[model samples]
Target: MSSYSAPLRDIRFTLFDLLDVESSFARLGFDEAGRDLVDPMLDEAARFAGTVLAPLNKAGDEHGVRYDKDSGSVTTAPGFAEAYRQFTEGGWSGLSAPAEFGGMGLPHVVGMPLEEMINSANLAWGNFPLLSHGAANALQHHGEDWQREVFLGKLVTGEWTGTMCLTEPHCGTDLGLLKTRAEPAADGAYSITGTKIFITAGEHDLTPNIVHLVLARLPDAPAGSKGISLFVVPKFKVGRDGAVGERNAVRCGAVEHKMGIHGSATCVMNFDGAQGWLVGQPHRGLMAMFTMMNTARLGVGLQGLGLAERALQNALRYARERLQSRSLSGPKYPDRPADPIIVQPDVRRMLLTCKALVEGGRALGYHAGLQVDLAAHAGSEEERRQADDLLGFLTPIVKGCLTEWGVECTYHALQCFGGHGYIAEHGMEQLARDARITTLYEGTTGIQALDLMGRKTMQLQGAGLKVFLGMVQAFCEQQAGNAALAEFVGPLAEKAREWQGLTMAIAKRAAGDPEEIGAAAHDYLFYSGYMVLAYWWARSVAAAEASSQPQAFRDAKRETARFYFARILPRTLAHKAAIETGPAPLLALDEAAFDA
Candidate 1:
């Protein structure tokens, strides 16, 4: 079993010590429940994850999920239902939900650390309720009054779960090619007919009901994405009195056998003339779906962070206890038969890399959370718009960069475990496998790159990028004289400038050549991701330096920041060079070029 503890020290450092979340909350008009509440909240969440959720993680992976096609029901791994019940009963499901829907109405900053804990404990189990929170977010934002009344409370309480059905066998990213149909019925409802694949939490026995936020086309809808419509199709319809009623027309056709996250039931759902209500405006379903998707994307990024944390914990524990050959300098521990593996430089390097990336990722994720909170609750309209734009710009970076780095971090942590890492018993292999899907799902890394470069960067005519650059510039200017952080801040500022210039160059070249944009998109996004993470590391280093703490904490922050800049941030140079090279070289090769 993998023994995992929440990084409470780091969490406290990030929340109160570094960000002063309490003061930020006060400025935002938060009530008497101030910063003092954060410690207890975090302690309670850590206990739940470490004791309740973490114990079931290995068991869930071993047991996987079984689907009964004849009965059209899904049975999750053992203890999952009970675990979910405990989670909901503890009011965790309502952590960040709106107060109007019976939720705790906490800010995203408050919910972020809890989310990291849950996902680290068990991603598969975490996903079941995670989607529900996301669905509630979409519904609360765009649902009609009746829809909110009917669905929000139960969803917030976890009596109901939710799924987003967008992918089909024929179309996953290209929603314009979707063939699902939604026909209007006489009663102010539509009958949906289609098959949705790769639907997580699509069908499960953990909740009383499952609500699917599906996308389909109207009979007279326009062609492509513009014609898409969103719907709320329930499993086990609700009665007028809010009781569970007849089963809806939607049913799980089959569940997929995936590479990882087996405990999360990925289902093929068949909507056979199922009754569903259109959400938001007609022909504006894509916009409504995005409202949920953007939030879910951020959730996915946290998932990556959580998995990386778990992997690091396992590796760090194993390295300290395992015996290995003597150190190059001498036998450091003469009392033992052999020295511990952690004394080795390469091993330290691996552990340090995980530490740096995970902590840096946490800072970035929390910053994004703060932006989201401000966007929702800021006093001024101008503040709200700026917050919204900042959040929008960082969303893709959070989703893409965190997830991509998550895989690398886990893989390196596994390498730290040596031969045992590849085996199933140590749990490192499972972490790697589970982390793999984070990049592929919730929109692939490639999709995120395209969004960052094309839609987010170019489409806005650089408005979002300019705002982001201004923030970095302001941070650099403010921290210029901090001798302790000069080394970290200066290099990061230079890299940010380099990235900005590269982005402008790409944008210019893309204007003349469409293919250049597509070719350069992935590398450009990565460059942006590295710089963002480096900038986050710089901010964290400065925050840590100001704290009254042990030299070890300050030393660790400075060391990790050094590792990121020296080893990790250099990749941006190559990425920038690739983007500057343009797409002509890539597009010039024909199919016959591979005929060797």
Candidate 2:
């Protein structure tokens, strides 16, 4: 198996150079999270991730997880328990949790790169802590004082893991169709009775207790999404004294046999009259869950960026070592039997695609993380509201675009390995398999696309879009006079205008036929994502050019930025055409005719 290493240089560049975490931390009131502290933490995290977690990845995939039917529990792959022990012992799980709850309380900007490093090293192993962060977000925001005292501390301390129980056999993305029941009980709690499927870290042996944030409906509650309520259901019951007690009615009925992330237990949880405390008010579950959902959505985007970074590293290493046909122009290595594959233009194309995607995606993801910090800690209300709006608008784009690009980058990386890539021993195949789920879960690409086009843009009347568009326009105008950046600035300005025009067109059309929104959703999503990336790529070039960095680094950024504009950004043109094609072609075929 190929060894995995965290790309610390690029990560540092992204954090300190592109996102400017030092300034951000200062502004956000995170005094303790300056570079002096964050750097050492990142170094330790990189060591833990690269040395401890990366080695477990292939072994985890091969061994998978063991389900004990009798105990109704799951055991993870070898070394998982000990690795998780070290992970939590290092206080890594609480990197961004609340300080009052036994956490480090760093900004998301710092935590996000650490997250990328871990996910890159071992995604399957990363899932265990990943879900805990989401659960913490939910509890911190909505949990009652008693509830926080009971559950929040353990979650932040990593003594217990957490899971989000929303999906059932009947429904996945559509939470409105959920049938889980939450009945009132005599103890002022509710009895949750239903089954949740595809629960990550649902039932694992790594922790003593598991906290589940479940969504269920009350008998007298109104129908659909509005009637749902959020509850904190533990695997083992906790007393008012905050001690673990007897097992609750919640149990893992079965573990899923999935294509990837086998080390992470994705289980079918059955809640048969399980005792649970409501986190937020009744019928406001969807709103409460958004706190976690939004966090998870952004985390999912990092998962994509992580996998792509790992894939790029392994592919670049292989490309430089593997001997293949001679270079098209001439043999770059005269002494060797044949030139390395890296000498070939086609191979460079694939490699550069991966490079550009991962780097640009990193900037986008980290920028969003900075927005998260601003939303939480900005000094002024106006700054907080603007940051929150931009974060909301970019969530779906980050989740949808990055995951799909992760898949693309992995495929390219695997192709670089040729026949060897298909084999399990090489580990590229595992990365490919794991990348597939990022898009399907959290929310599928189509779901994110719909959210971006319908709910975020049209429903809100482009409030978020206006904020982002303004940023792009301002940047483009500033760079218009810079001759060194004209190649990028001019096109980016044009694309920004087109993006705004497209939104207006879609809004108008949707007013007459709602299907118009659905029709243009997927296309608009890619179009918006590509445009966002274009802006970032341009900014990266400008940053690199103005920096005191070495000439090679600046050259690489300029070259990659050029490649992105010339090759990938043109993809938006196709998306634009497809959007204009409207819903007619897609909806033309009758049901019987489609089947035929």
Candidate 3:
């Protein structure tokens, strides 16, 4: 079996050493976000995650949730409600919320590590509060003044919870195909009637009300995504003055029995002419909905990172404790009948793979979180725009790569445990199962690739790419004098140049043949992800070398970066080759040929 202690040392290294977030926060007008205050919050967050949430992970997976068909009510896994209450009482929901709305008003970067810990401790339990961040994002950017007053504060304070209700049985990624209908009600609220599938935390006992940010087409709506609108539909209706009223028409129809994350209710939500008010402009709901989706996309990336961390920790511990044959070179621990499996080279390969991806990914993910803060709070509009651009560029790569790696890391971690890993008691299998959904739910990896290529690259003309490449160039120049970082700097710079050329190449190809985008998108995204991680891995080595961390820690970072460069980063080469193939290779296989 495995356990999780918050990876505080590495988290701090990422936050302060790599990102220098305290300085960044101060520069962005967060006076109270200094390390003095942030440190204690981190400690408390770790304590709560470890002591409370960690114990519940296995229980949640095993017991899942209890659903009453007659009442259409769902009781979450044991202790889930209590833990959620504690989470709210501890004021964690407001960690990155605006101070004006009853939140602590900390920077999102500050909340990033805390979020990782929560997910690591219990992925299922973490689902309860995760969407609130997105719901709050949608409301903050798009909600009307009265709507904000009526609902936003409660969401920020965790007095209530929130969900994104977008998918129906017929469509998921294609929001334009959704058939949910929203008609005008007498009191100015919309009457929403639809069945939303795969709704996380759709109905639960954790809070008195669940605010659903639903996407539905209006009576006069056009045929596709452009015509959709956003609405705030709550389970228990509330008055304009903020007082809770009678139950609305929204209810849980059924809970899915899934492969993983059983503790969290994945409900089929039925909105039976539910009363909700409009959010943002009509026919602009997709725009507003994306505000929530982009936020959730980043959050989902961390889900993968979080699972990798827990799985790696468990596997590493197993490697050290489990006895196997002596090392091929020689016996390292002669006292035991056999040396620990950790002495074996192949075992080291699996462990190190997890280590390199997990550590480097943490830094990359944390850096993106910092960009979010800068995007919102930077000194100038131009600065904010640049930050947002960089963030957009990184989002798909972060989500796509990290989630795919999360599954990979968990697989390797489980492999390290051998047969025991296959057994449920080892808990590695549960992690592997849980990590599967991250990539699938928040726009599948394929969808993320399309977004990166189609929207971010082609439509925006690689604005985000330009911003990121500029950072890579600036970093390489700044670190030129540091001989210790020279090894990584040279390769990273080479990759950065290659990435720019590769982008131009693909854009040129797609210009001639539109199918080139689809053909190259998946591989191009992986290539970008590998390059991004390479940059972060290089930065991590520099951060470790420059910090006051112990020599062993520094050496470990150096060695892991070496492993990444040698083993993992080269995956880009294969992706690049695939990207250059155009569309002929894929499209040559006609639909009938496969069956024939």
Candidate with the greatest lDDT versus the true structure:
3
Overlapping backbone residue pairs in candidate 1 total: 0
Give the root-mean-square deviation of each candidate in angstroms: 1.4, 1.0, 0.9
List residue ranges in candidate 1 displaced over 4 A: 239-244
Tens digit per residue, CA lDDT, model 1, 1-596: 66679999998888877777888788787774476777898999999999998999999888889999898899999999999999889898888787888888888889999999988999999889878877888888888888899999999989899999999999989999999999998878889999999999999989878999999999989999999999999997654345667889999999889888989999999999998888898888999889889888999999999999999998999989999998999999999999999999999989988998899899888888899898999999988888888888888889998898789889999999888899887899889999999998889999999998888888876666777788889999998998878898788788778777888888788888888879988997888888878887888888887898688998888889899999888988798788878787787889788785
* TM-score, one value per model: 0.98, 0.99, 0.99
**Collision pairs in model 2:** none
Which scores greater on TM-score, model 1 or model 2?
2
Off by over 4 Å in 2: none
Lowest summed lDDT over 10 consecutive residues: which window, candidate 1?
236-245
lDDT of each: 0.88, 0.91, 0.92
- C-alpha lDDT (0 to 100) for residue 538 of candidate 1: 87
